[model samples]
Target chain A: MSSPVNPDFLILAVQFVVAFAIAIVSLVGYRMFGSRTLFRMALSFFLIGGGILVQDAGNIATELAGFGPELSILGLVLEALGYFVLAISHIYTVRSEVGAEVSSMTLLLPFFAAAVQPSTALVLEGVARSVSFFLLLYILSENIIFLVKNRNAEALLPIVGFALLLASLFIRLFFVLPTETSDLVDLLKLAGFLILSGPVLVLLVRLRGGPP
Target chain B: MMIVSDILKVVKEEGSKGEGARISSLLRKANLPYNRLTEITDRMVSNGLLEVTPQERGSIYRITPKGEEVLDSLIKFEEFAKAFGLRL
Candidate 1:
C-alpha cells in the first residue's frame, strides 16, 4: 500500500512555491531595471527558495531515520546567508556609489555558528534573526524619511510593506506565542512578502508595455 | 556616475513639453556632459526610447511612446528606491 503524504511536506511545498514566485518576480525586476541591488535581491530570494527545498529534503531524511532537527541546521544556515545577502542588497540600494566594497564580504556567520557550537544553535539563530530585524528596521526608517520629505503617494506602498515585514520580524524576535497562535507569526511574514510583491509585480506589468 | 534613470527623466520632462528639445537644452536640464548625453541619447534612440530629428539649428530629441512607458516604470522604480533611501 502507498504511504500517506506527510503534512509537513505539503507545507514545505507551499513555501517553496511562494519563494520561487518571489525569486522569479525579483529576477524579472533585475532584468528590467538593470540594477545591481535588484540582482542581489533576486539572488537572495533564490537562496531562500533553495534553503527551503534543502530543509524539506533534510526533514524527510531525518524523519525516515528517526533523527531530530540536527540536519535541518543546514537549511537554517542557508536562510541566514540569504538574509545577510538581502541586507547587503538594501545597503547597495541606499548607497549606489559603493559597489566592489559592498559585494566583497562573504557571510559566514551562520555556518560558523552551526559548526563551532551546535548546542548554542538557538542563540545563534536569535542573533541572526536580530541582525535581519535591525537591517529591516533601517530600511523601513529610510523609507519613512523619504516619504516624509517627498510626500509621494506611491512611496506609501513600500512603506506599508516594509512596516508589515518589520512587524513580523518584531513578533519573531520578542513574542513567544502558544502553539495555537504560533502560526500567526508565519502568516504575518507571508503577508509581508505578498505585500512587497505587489509593487514588484506592478513594475513587471508596466515593463511589459515598454521596450525590452 | 550619473544614473541612466536621471538622464531618462530629463529627456522625458523635456520631451513631454510637446516641442522637441535641443541637445544643449537637454545637457543643461539633465546636468550631464556633452559626450555622456550624446552616448545616452544614442542608446535610447536605438532602444526605441527616443526619437531624434535633424533641424536647421541642431538635432531635436523627443520621447517616444515607448519612452513614456519606460518613464512610468522608472517612476515606480524611483518609489521603490526611495523606500530604501536610494535614487533610481
Candidate 2:
C-alpha cells in the first residue's frame, strides 16, 4: 500500500520545532529581564506557541484516526484561540508601560468567544489573526513613541522586533485569507517565525545586561 | 540611594538655572554639591529610576516610582545609619 500523504503533519512538524525554540528562548529572555510584565508576556507567547504545536500535532493524529476535515478544523480553531489570548496579553503588557491600561481579566473575551464557536475554524482563526496583528501594531507604535522620547538602543530593539512581528502578521493574513493551499500559509508562518524569533533572541541577550 | 542622587544629578545636568535646581536645593541641604554628586544619577536612568526625556543636547529627567521607593529606602537607611553613629 502506498503511504498516505499527510501535508498538515509535515507542516506542523516543522512549525513545532521552530515555535518550540522561540518559546524557550523567550522564556530565557524574560528571566533575564526579571520584569513582571515581560515575564508574563513571555509566558503568554510560550502558551500560544505550544498550543499551535499541539494543534498541529493533533491534526496529524486525527488523520491517523481517520478523522475528517471537519475535526481537523476544530484543531485549527483551538490553536487560533490560544493565539488570541497570547495577543491580548502582549497588548496589555506594552500598554501598561505607558499607563494606557488594559485589564488582565478582559483577556477572557477571546477565550470565551473561541470556546463558544469551536466549530467555525475559519471565523475564529480570522478573528484571532486580526487581533494579533492589531496588537502587534499597538505594541510597535508604543515602542516607537518610547524610542522617540528616549532615543536609546535598548528601546530600539523592541521596536524593531515588534515592527517585523507586525509585518509578519500581514504575511499571515494573506496566507489565512486564501486557504486554497497550505503551502503559502506554511511559508508565511515560517517567515513570521523568522521575524518574530530573531528579535526576541536579541532582546533576550540585551536583557542579560540589566540587573535581574 | 543612588537613584535619588541620579535624579538630582540629571536635574542639575539639564541646566544650571530654573526650578531644576530644586534637586540642587535638596542636595545642598545634605551638603552635596551639584558638581560632585554624580555617582548615583548616572545609574538611575539606566536602572529605570528616573525617566530620561531627551532634548536638543541634554535631557529632562524625572523620578519614577522606582526611584521614589529607592529614595525612601535611602532616607530610612540614613536615619538608621545616623542612629548607629555611622556617618553617611
Candidate 3:
C-alpha cells in the first residue's frame, strides 16, 4: 500500500514557497536600488529563506531515511543566525558609531549553547527567533510613531504589514492552536510577507525604467 | 555624512517648480557647497538621475523621471530607517 502523505510536509512546502518568493523580491530590489540598506535586507531574507529550506530538507531526510536529529538542530541554528544577521542589519542602519569590535565568543555563544545542550536546542532557537521578532516590533513601533508625528501617509502599508507579522509571532509564542489549524499561523506569516513585498516590487518596477 | 537619498531629495524639491533650478539655487536649497554640489550633480547626471541644460546665465539642473523614481525609493528608505529609529 502507498504511504499517506504527511500534512506537515505540505505545510512546509507552502512555507518554503512563500519564503523563497520574499527572498527573490528582496534580492531584486537590492540589485535595482543599489543601496546598503537594501543589500542588508536582501541578505536577511535570503538567509532566512535558506534556513527554512534547510529545515525542510532535514525533515524529509529524517522521515524518509531515519537520519539523526543533528540535521534538524543545525537547521534551527541556521535560522537563528539568520535572525541575528537581521538584527545586525538594523543596528548597522541606525547606529552611527558601529565598531568592528565584535567578539568571537559572542558570535559562538548560540552554537555553543545549542551544542552543549542538544535537547534544549529547540528552545534556544525559539528564544533567538523571539529576540528577532521583538527587535522588529520595536523598530516598527518607532517608525509608526515617527510617521504619525510627521503625518506621512506612506506609513500605512508598512504599518499594516508589520502589524500582521507581530500578531503572528505573538500567536506563535503564546497560544497553541489546534493541530489541524496550526497552519493558520503560517498563512498569516505569508500574508504579512506578501504585504511587505508589494511596495518593494512597485519600487523595483519604477527603478527599472532608469539607467542601471 | 550626506546620503544619496538626501541629495536626491534636494534635487527633486528644486525641480518640483518645473522651471529647473540653477546651480546657485540648488546649492542654496541643498545646503551643499559649490564643489560638493557640482560633484554630486555630475555623478547624478551620469547616473541618469538628473539632466543638465546649459543656458546663457548658468547651467540648469532638472530631475529626470529616473531621478523621481529614485526619490520615491528614498522616501521608502526613509520610512524603513525610521522604523529603526534612524533619521535618513
Candidate 4:
C-alpha cells in the first residue's frame, strides 16, 4: 500500500518554489543592473530555497529511510544564513562600512548557536534560528525607515511582508503553539513570501511582451 | 539602464534593412557625450547586444535580437522597481 502524503510537504514545497523563482529573477536582475543589492537578494533567495529543500529532504528521509533530524538542522542553519545575507548585504550596500556589524555577528552568533545542541547540526541550527530572528528584526527596521523617508505606498507591501516574517520567526523561535495554530503560522509566513514576490511577479508578466 | 535601453531603442529605430545607424547619428539622437556613447556602444557590442559594422572614419551600430530582448527586459525591470518604490 502507498503511504499517506504529508500535508506539510505541500506548504514547504510551495515556499521552495516561490523562493527559487525569486532567486532566478534576482540573478537576472543582478546581471542586468550590476548592483550589489540585487546580488545579495539573489544569494539570499537561493539560500532560502536551499534551506527549504534540505528541510523537506530530512522529513522525507526520516519517514522513508529512518534517518535522523541532522539534515533538518542543517536546513535551519541555511535558513538563518539566508536571512543574515539579506540583512548584512543591504546594510553594506547602503552604508559601505560594515566592519562593526560583521565583528559583532561573528562573536555573537556562535554563542547563540551553542545554547541548545547535543550535536553539531543542532548547535548550528540554534545559531541559525537566533541569527534569523535578529537579522529579520534589523531588516524590518530598515524597511520601515525607507517607508518613512519615501512615503511610497508601494513600499508598504514589503514592509508588512517583512514584519509578518519577523513575527512568524519570533513565534517559531520562542513559543510552541498547538498544531492548528502552527498551520496558521505557516500561512502567515506564506503570505509574507507572496507579498515580497509581488514586484517580480508583475515584472514577469510585463516581460511577456517581448519577442520569444 | 534607461540610458542603455534608450541607446538600444535608437539603434533599433534608425538601423534597419542592414543599413545600421552611423555613430554620428547615434551621438546626435541618443544625446550622450562622445566618450560615454562609444564606451556604452563598445560594451554593448562586446556583450552582443549591438552589432558594429565598419564605415569610413567610424562604425555603424545595430541592435541584435539579444539587445532587443535585454532592452525589453530592462524596461520591464525599471517599471517593476518603480512599482515597488525601489531605486535601481
Candidate 5:
C-alpha cells in the first residue's frame, strides 16, 4: 500500500537486497566451483554476516530503540570485512581479464591480521569500509578525465554504482550519529545508498548477467 | 594458468612413445575420455608447455623446456607427499 521512495528507507531496502544476493552467490560459488580455500570462505561468511548485522543494527536503532549509539560494533566490523571481500571480488576480475595470478599468500595476510587483532582489525575494517568511497572517487575522477578527453556518457555508468556506494558509506561514516548530525548529511547518505546499491545491482545484472 | 598437477594428469595418462604415429597422431592419441584435444593443444602451445618439431621422417612430440620444469615440480610434489606419508 505504501510507495518506497523515502530515501533512507529505500537505501536500507536496497542494501538488504544487495547483501542477500552477495550471500547467495558466495555460498553457491564456494560450494560448487571455488578453490575451497578455508580462509577466503571464512572471509565471505564474515562479510555476509556483517551486511546482515549492519542492516539489523540500523533497523533496531532507527525504529525500536530511538537511541542510536553503537548498537552493533560487531556488525560494523563485519561490514568492513564485507566490503573487503567485495574489493577482493573486483580484484579477482583481473584473473578473467588478464590471466594473471595473485599469490594465495598475498591474499591471506590482511585477513589473518584482521581476524587475530581486534584493534588492528578495527583500523583495517575502517580503511576497508572506505573502499567504495575511494573507488567512487576514482571512477568519478576518471570519468571526468575521459569526458574531457573523449566525451562519452557510457564511461559514466560504472560510476553510478560507485557513487551509490560512496553515498551509503558517507552516511555511515559521517551522518548516522547521536542526535546532532545535519539533516542534509542524512538525506545525502540515504540517497547515495539507494543509488549505489540498487542501480549497481541492475548494472551488474545487465553487464555481468549476475552478481560477481 | 593450468597447474602442474593438471598437466601431469594429462601427460601421465596420455603418454605414448611410438614412432610412425606423427605428432598430430600422438596428440590425437593422447586425449582423455573427456578432453577436447584441439583446445588442449592450443593451450599447450600458448603456454610454451608443449612442442612439436618436424623431422625428416615425421614430426616429434616433446614437452617444451618449461613444460619439463613443470613436470619436474609436479614429480617433486609427488615424492614429497609420499615421503611425508600422505596420499592424495
Candidate 6:
C-alpha cells in the first residue's frame, strides 16, 4: 500500500547529509587550528550543502513548485558564494593578521552578486564555475603531492572524483543550459562528492576523537 | 597556531623533567631557530600555556595544564589535516 520513493529527494538527502557533515568537521578544524582557511572552508561546505537543498526546493516541496525559477536562482547564488569562499580558502595567502582584511575582501563579491542584481545570475554562474574548477584543481594538486610524498594509493579516490568534477566544470563552460549537460554535471559532482567523502571520513573521525 | 602547538609538544616532551627544559636543549629538540623559539616561548608564557623558571644559566620552559589541553586539540587537528592530505 506504500507509494514509491522519489529518487531526487533521496539524492538530495545524501548530498545534504554529506555536505553538512564535512562542514561540521571543517568547523571543528577551524576551532582547533584557528586558521582562516578552515573557517572559510567550513563556510563554503555549509553553503554548498544548504544550496543543494534550496536549489531543489521546488522538487522536494509541492507547494513551492511554482517558485522554481526564482528559488533555483537563489540557490545558484548560494552555491556560487559557496564556491567563492572555497576558492578563497585555497588561494588566500595573508597569514597572521586579525583577518579582517581577508574576510572583508573575499566575502563581498558573492554577497553582491547574490543579493543585489538578478541579472548578475549569469555572471554569478560563470564565477561559480571558475572558482569551483580552481578549487578542485588546487585540491587535486595537493592530493598528487601528498601521494608522491607518502605513496598513498588512497589519494586516488579524491583525485579521480575531483577530475570528474573538473571535467564537468569544463563542459559547463560550453553548454550552460543543456539538460543533458546539466545532468552530466550533476552525475559527476555526485560521484565526486561521494568519493571525496571517503577521505573526509578520516577527518571526521579525527575531529570526533574516534580511532582512525 | 601550528608552531605554538609544536613548541608546546616539544616542551612537554623534553621539559617534563627536573627544572624543565633549557632554551638551548629546546632549540635542538624543537627544530626551531633560537629567536623564534624564545619569541614564541615568551608568548606562550604570557598565554599561560607555558611557565618559565628563572635560573642562573637561563630560563627553563615547561608545559602547563592549559598547554596540555591545547596540545590535545592541536594534535587531533593536525592528524585530521594529515588525513585530508594537508601539511597544516
Judging by lDDT against the true structure, name the best candidate.
4
> A1-212 in candidate 4: lDDT tens per residue?
21426666777787888889878887898897675556777798899889988988887877788884888877877877787777665565345356746643653464455565565665566566777778778777767776677676666777787788888888877887999999888888888888888777767767776432
State the lDDT of candidate 6 residue by residue for A1-212, as single tens digits. Answer: 21224555566667778778878887977886676666876898899888878866845444434435556556656766676666455344323344645653754554554445445656656655555565566656765676677776666776786677678677876665676557667777777678767757765565567774
Per-model TM-score versus the true fold: 0.74, 0.49, 0.69, 0.69, 0.41, 0.70
By DockQ, the better pick of 1 and 2 is 1
Q: What ranges in model 1 sit over 4 Å off?
A: A1-15, A60-65, A68-71, A99-124, A152-177, A204-212, B76-87
B22-65 per-residue lDDT for model 6 (tens digits): 88887887788889888889988998999999999998888998
Give candidate 6 misplaced runs (Cα > 4 Å). Answer: A1-5, A58-64, A93-131, A142-157, A171-185, A207-212, B16-20, B25-39, B46-48, B64-66, B82-88
Native A-B contacts reproduced, model 5: 0.00
Interface RMSD of 2: 17.6
CA RMSD per model (angstroms): 4.6, 12.9, 5.2, 5.9, 13.6, 5.2
lDDT (Cα, tens digit) per residue for candidate 2, span A26-135 = 45534543334334444555555665666665565655665544444444444454454444444553455444244544545655654566546567666666656655
Residue B12 C-alpha lDDT in model 4:
88
Q: Model 3 over residues A105-136: C-alpha lDDT tens digits?
A: 24445556545553565575566556546655
Question: For model 1, how does the per-residue alpha-carbon lDDT over A162-196 read when each residue is reduced to its tens digit?
Answer: 68767876887898888556567656655665666
Q: What stretches of model 2 exceed 4 Å from their correct place?
A: A1-18, A29-33, A68-118, A125-127, A130-134, A140-181, A200-212, B1-88
Pitting candidate 2 against candidate 5, the one with the higher TM-score is 2
The weakest ten consecutive residues by lDDT in model 4 chain B span: B79-88
* lDDT (C-alpha) at residue A149 in model 2: 56
Instruction: List A-chain TM-scores for all predictions.
Output: 0.69, 0.59, 0.68, 0.83, 0.48, 0.67
| Model 3 global lDDT (CA atoms, 0 to 1) | 0.63
Residue A175 in candidate 2, Cα distance off native in Å: 7.4
RMSD in Å for model 1? 4.6
Output the worst ten-in-a-row residue range by lDDT, candidate 3 chain A: A97-106
Clashing pairs for model 1 are: none
Order the numbered candidates by DockQ, best leading. 6, 1, 4, 3, 2, 5
